[model samples]
Target chain A: MTMLEVLDVSGLVTFQDSGRRGWQSYGVPLSGPMDWFAHRAANSMLNNSTDAVVIEIGLGEAMFRAKRDCVLAVTGTGFEVVNYIWTFPLWTSFYVRAGWRVQVKKISGGNWAYLGVAGGFEAQSMLGSKSTYLRGGLGSAIRAGDILEAGKPARELAKLTARNFPVEKFMNYSQSPVIEVIAGPQQDRFTEEGVQTFYGSEYTLSKSFDRMGYRLELLPSPSSAKGIAQATSADLLSEGMTLGSIQVPDNGQPIVMMADSPATGGYPKIANVIRADLPLLAQCEAGVSKIQFREIMLEEAQENFQKLNKAFKTPKG
Target chain B: MLKPLGDSALLVQLGDEINPALNQRVHALNALLQNPIHGILETVPAYSTLLIHYDPLTLTFDQAAHWVRDKMTQLDDSFHRTPRRLEVPVRYGNASGPDLETVAVSKGISPADVIRIHSEREYTVYMMGFTPGFPYMGTLDERLIMPRIATPRTLVKAGTVAIAASQTGIYPLDSPGGWHLIGWTPLKLFDPTSETPFLFSPGDVVKFIPLESLESNSLLFDQ
Candidate 1:
């Protein structure tokens, strides 16, 4: 059996697929790659199934020992994959011989990185997905000494040609980028001034953030304009929350829900990052990056989303 | 009220009020839309809203909105199904409920009276969220209504039955919580290994049955 043995791993590295759907009604969140664009790109490089399981490493390092010759790809930033003596570039696939020690170094820029096998990795599927919901303890994180089996290759031979990927589309780590967002359903919960402050001001991601969501602090301003003001009735009947939904608690600070956010929440949501820009938001490393939100019409958001999907549709080398 | 939740999902809210009528409408729409529609993905039923996720490429927002409006007009309000009533055996004091005496003192009622009142009513499962298999059931007696703890405990044991405001819920997993703990059920609300991971859905009926002693209730906590 083709296997990759985990010699060492850092941070929260876990197996992930497209995520679990149809189970939200049972209170399960869609826990998958924070940067989906990177996840898909890595899978596409190896020609794995679009929803195949990959290792999602967050700001940490991982070392793997290949048991058999295999083609693999790594995407996202802040880390480099080293095979004993040779260093592999990001956003490209490479063939590793048996007994090669592949190690992902510590992330210096971005918070998330994805590593995908040619035929995907074998994982225990819970509720139709291999995605690990860490809070629920559904699937498990990769631990040292764990044997990760790679699926049988669909194609026997690997294509030696390494093609370039449009990094700007889905790859941005440690850069301060203006994220695009659509006004959330409960935008009215914020006053007009609050809305203006939200769109006009810059925010820094707090250190106390994880896969569930990011807590942001308002940047210092010259004017008396501070954080946004929340409505008196801040609590709502709990409703289903989507990824990128920015919820404002009584504290008035916005918390953008991530891939592992609760399926439903009671806080008032002021905005949601557009699907096209979620990758950009996900790449904004906590405690290292700052962000600003740019409001966009739903039509513009939809058009951008289509463009992103189209980029992935084109045949890769 | 219909609102777009990002590009992939649309949320149809019946009303924000926690009442049977609003929940029924949400449940009715969810029940009707359970079957797969062209390009439509999964549907999640919350307390008073049905969130529908769909592929934007196959179906535009306008098309999905129009389809939902059309579907709403044909909703069967009289449609009814017998809800499965789950009897949860609960231990009301000691380690099961750390705040039982505190809650009684706050309400100016005896601990035994608190248990009697809590166990007497059948709570409707309004929704499930916060964590996997955590059921948010509601409409507690106004007299027993109390605010959540000022500072939430870092870790609340799984199966802890807690109350706050007008709602009663059980923490399916061991999680941090702010609710006033009153009791705990021996039954597992969630089991990932089981075929049906969740013990209760949005519309299920749950009746808390107080136990004299949890030591004898070995069948409930088989784990």
Candidate 2:
């Protein structure tokens, strides 16, 4: 069995897979990579299955030594991979010979980055997931002196030249960054002015953002609604929450729930980020990233979703 | 009452307000849905609503909504029968409960009186959320109602007993919290290593016993 020794790890580094599903019934939030598209892309680059465990690096540097020759790729924002002491940016694939040391440097832009080994890193699974939930003390983030096992029996790599995968034709932060949305069940609960403001005005990404939710600072709205508030007074019953659900609590500010959000919340959701644009939201950088919402038909949303999935399924040569 | 929550989920609401009967109904439906039901991916119980999450691939939104309605209609006298009662022990009014005096003053009652009233009444476990193992028990004695602090403390130690909005509960982990601390409990409400991670499930009844009683009898707190 091949293993990688962690020479250094950042404070926020952890192991993430597609996430532990079917456990929300026990009050566990779905803990996984904040950016699913990047996670899958990193896995795909190595020809690993979509759900293979990958290292989720955040805001710090990790130095490791490969015990075996393996193909690897880095995806998501910020951070760069230094192989043989050379820096490679996001979405590129490379091969590292056995015994070569690789270092992931501090994030330069985004909050998270993913490093996927050709044969996925193996770790103890809890509740059928390799992902770590820091809040619950399930799995700790990767640390120095920690050893990680690689998945399964290794196979010989076919003699092949490294090639760049063409960027897919889909929405990302770098592309048409607007997020499409649908009118929510509680959209009517907001004052008519609030609704107009929501669509017409732009919001900046607040500094306070994480896997739980993203708080968007509301711009001064000329048509701001005065007192349109959440209808249900009681704390909402716990229920299935998902990525892109826009929750508005009593404070009048809206929070876009992300992957790790609880199964339920008391805040009334004003809209859901269209499925196609959720990936874009995942890749967005903090700061004054302008946000505007446009309503689209459910059928159109589904079509866009299918298109994105199809692009993801297409193999890169 | 039920409403369309979204294309993929439906909200089966009991009422606009939190009522014990409604909470029990939500829990009953949750238990009923747990046995590998078709099309239902997840059923989550909240303070006043039960959100049924279904797979859009297996069942259409309308079909899932209809299924939930059908299940609710089939529920009868047997569903609302006696719930499991759990006795929890708490050590009140020390570092465990930093806000005990504050809460007592806010309610115009003595700290000792607050403890007596809180311990005497049995509360319902309305839902489990806000954090893992954080039980949202409700129907607290009206005398204990207190507003959440205007400025929420950034950190509240785990097992810190707290009260807010006519409800009483325990913090499962040390996280940023706002609930008024009344006391602390030594029992671990949520341990991921345990076969059953959650100490209290929805529809369960919870009674708080004084820590003095547990110490005197040398009795272990068991659910």
Best TM-score among the predictions, by candidate number: 1
Per DockQ, the best of the predicted structures is 1
lDDT string for model 2 (B50-100, tens) is: 777765545666677677777888676576557899988898886778888
Docking quality category of candidate 1 according to DockQ thresholds: medium
- For each candidate, report its DockQ versus the true two-chain complex: 0.73, 0.38
Assess every candidate by TM-score.
0.95, 0.88
The pairs that clash in candidate 2 are A236-A266, A236-B47, A237-B46, A237-B47, A238-B45, A238-B46, A239-A263, A239-A264
lDDT scores in order: 0.84, 0.74
* Every model: iRMSD: 1.1, 2.5
Q: After best superposition, candidate 2 residue A158: deviation in angstroms? A: 3.1
Q: For candidate 1, lDDT tens digit of each residue in A1-317?
A: 55798999988999999998788888899888999989998887677788999999896789999888888888888788898788989888888888989998865667888988888999999888899988998888899999888787656635622645677654345468899898899998888888888888888888888999989888778521457886566368789889999998877788999999988888888999988888877877776677989988888888888777786785554
RMSD of 1: 2.2
Chain B TM for prediction 1: 0.92
